[model samples]
Target: MATEITTAPHDGSTDPASPARLCGRLLGRVETRLHDFLAAERELRTRVDARAAAPIDALTALIDSGGKRIRPAFCVAGYLAAGGDPASEDIVAAASALEMLHTCALIHDDVIDASPRRRGLPTVHARHSAEHARNGWEGEPRRYGESVAILAGDLALIYADQMMSEASPSLGAAWAELRSELIIGQFMDVVVAAEFSADVALSRWIAVVKSGRYTIHRPLLIGATLAGRPELEGAFEAYGDALGEAFQLRDDLMDAFGDSDATGKPVGLDIEQHKMTLLMGLAMDRDRRTREFVLGAERDPAEVRRLLDETGVRMDVEAHIDRLVEKGRAAIDAAPLDERWQRELGAMAHQVAYRNS
Candidate 1:
């Protein structure tokens, strides 16, 4: 998922090596690498298969769109925390690759969501679908659009793998694991939604495997592996697991009630899609209204939202998020990171949980 961070100047010195400067500064490298790589790839695709440049353009445009750079930042943070050279080509390439993989996921996700808008603009599929319509294509606009988007996502995954291939072999295993988890998570998500399964354990497992492991935990491990710091593995997982849970919990909340402009997604999507979440699982166990509301949300979302409000699951979820964030904080406190990363990651945790998008 993409995020938008709000920055404030640090109180201390304006030293070049300060943690205060690292967060947004490292993102500059990521953006530059992404731009340069995509430009080269665009030229290469144009020469080899000119028509293929369209999807590449879509991917590049999406990257150019605004983002908080959370995943790449986490990779950099882990590398720095492990004393890896941030200026080294390996780390920069790996970090950029993480963002590419994220792009791939979002493309596929937008296809799954059939979402029209992302980051306040047309999603890759929607953009292509509109183009198909404008061209007076001879087939269904949506099918043509979605098929192109799948190819774009596949191409993105290929580019991500190509970018990270330059990194150390140790990083390769984590990369494979991450891709596998992503596929499995998507599969599980579909099953849960299709069946409307309220099994609490299944819901939690989906959260852990999908968002928790894929987003935060593996990235942390990937960073540490790049630095050759195997000792930090347990600590990385601990910190990542909690933060990842908080991240998804917040995502679900945003899907339920956030402004379309603020979230870059339609409000009440979870209800509209009937996606299973832990909050839904808990609410189901407590009363019948939650189930009724979820079932009715597709037809009359406002009433379902009202029913949801009366059920009080929203407040319960808020408290649960607080608890998970605290666990993440405690893990960070006990981790073998330096003072600089300790402060940086602590601040990052709050950003992950409390972010508006």
Candidate 2:
């Protein structure tokens, strides 16, 4: 929403639709499709009783907040780029399934991060906690809030699986692999975060499993598998790996500096929570004084800013961002891709590094 109008330059030969623009177009397509799917599934809302309304309400808020819907677009794009028909049932099924998977992840991520807001609105736990407090019927607000959020996240996971299962038979294998990767990746993320054993190597491992694979790679792979392309496998994998890291690194940057309106979460959540991000870990290892400053800083926003300024964490973080961009570019170059696909992938890589939201 920054009115700087940072549109990518294009010419007639580029079809007036750069890869980033095409990503937005494809995301719009999937968003409409998902809205229809949710409308059809709204019957589940009516089925739940009043006693369980909290979870339903939380889920509804999440659905309303929505997102970029990029994962499904990635799935569909990979499918079509590999010669799969857009109208094919398998393609639609995979795209829809990927969206559901993403939705499930968001619900769980909000809970794990203990985020009070998303999209400038109260997060599920925050909303439920407020409701509980108003009713004056709770023992502890935090306990009740967390419990409801946990159940809400569970319901989202169940619904995601249900959506995938109801898809066409041809997409079963793709769906299975995606779900498996998601679960494994999520578990790995939780373990790594909890243990605080995240160095650059561990961060890279978690990045591929937790963010890279599910967010980009697996979805693309599923789409390509649906298209029955044996040759494009390596390219798709490489694209996902690079794109996924780019996405996560961008997210880390956003957690540090993005506007609340743009990113839909409080800035500095990563610093406050002491999340083990690659940027922080790399900075810590590169400069002992920077590490000491970050460790010594208070959780207040002003103090955190001062620490970053005084110890050069911000500069170090910016350097790591540049490194990630370079790595992404190299991976895209190494992929077995033609001019059109390479251009698309390059645009995506750039977008990932430069994205504000």
Candidate 3:
């Protein structure tokens, strides 16, 4: 949900108008805006005096630990590029809703994946699991842990829906479609991991649903919709596809080579969890040895790396990542974006490709 991006702290080497600069500037703006939004939500919670505030305690931690608010910033950027008002409460609401939706997805995703960490801290499940054990107030410890996390994720989704509803019912139908695609994507990821659909076509479908629509297309579509730029919707959709693919490529790269401390999750998690990412698919698709290695793999990272090395799987996957980067840049180039947004988009493409997290 955080649409994880990897970037180093400011080194003062890049110009302010550079893509890195734009990304940093935009991220700063998002952080500031998110704080305001969370404060408002907290104020609302105080008035409601409901159990919903329980999740609010860790909410800021989770949000603040996020890699970057790339999706929400893109939504706002796209909206503005399409001649939309950045000051529109509805537009801001829509961007905020997307962020919430992404958070909900990540909460559920971490639970489903049984991930122990995120953004360099204990994942929600891990936090709750530890708490459950410390309190020693229940049945099976794992069950308690999973149950609390499930409830937390559910709460996030509920709050996200509430936020979306406040964004204007005009976005309801589109939001529903986006939500459905996300579910379908998650399901496909699970099924593929179980060896249900190990084909290349199926992997592509998963890419479209998981990364394409969820992160790229849907967010941009919502932005354009709010901007009322109906004519250029197709262009935005195309841009989203490329950007989303680029985003996923980076995800695959980070999964393999990222800093566990930075990503807030363990490295080699995809291999450990057996999630069917496009990188894994490319590895398998390349040769018979790669297929055997991946399929018969254990949870051992060294073994996985060895297999990847022997079959050139890692190299092949890395090559595909480069290709995706080029494709994303080309798509952005083709898109009808304003100069400012175009520069930002190009810079993001670089970050997506080269990110170490």
Give the candidate number with the greatest TM-score: 1
- Tell me the RMSD of model 3 versus the true structure: 3.7
Model 2: per-residue Cα lDDT over 1-357, one tens digit each:
221111333333445444445444455555566666665556556566546456655665666675655667667656655666645655665666676666667767877888898877887777778878999973988778877877877776776666556655566666677678777767766676666553777777667766777777777777777777646667666667766776777787677767888887798887777777765666567677556655664436456556565677667666666776667657657765455655655555565567787
Kindly provide the TM-score of model 2 when superposed on the true structure, using C-alpha atoms.
Answer: 0.82
Model 1: per-residue lDDT, tens digit, 80-147? Answer: 78887757778888888988999999999999988898888899999989999999989999999999
The 0-to-1 C-alpha lDDT of every candidate, in the order given, reads 0.80, 0.66, 0.70
**lDDT of model number 2:** 0.66
TM-score per candidate: 0.94, 0.82, 0.86
TM-score of 1: 0.94
Model 1: lDDT of residue 273:
74
Better of 1 and 2 by TM-score: 1
Ranking under TM-score, best-scoring first?
Answer: 1, 3, 2
As a whole number from 0 to 100, the lDDT of residue 71 in candidate 2 is 67
- Using lDDT, give the best candidate's number: 1
Candidate 1 segments exceeding 4 Å error: 1-13, 292-299
Candidate 1 clashing pairs? none
In model 2, how many backbone clashes occur? 0
Tell me how many clashing residue pairs each candidate has. 0, 0, 3
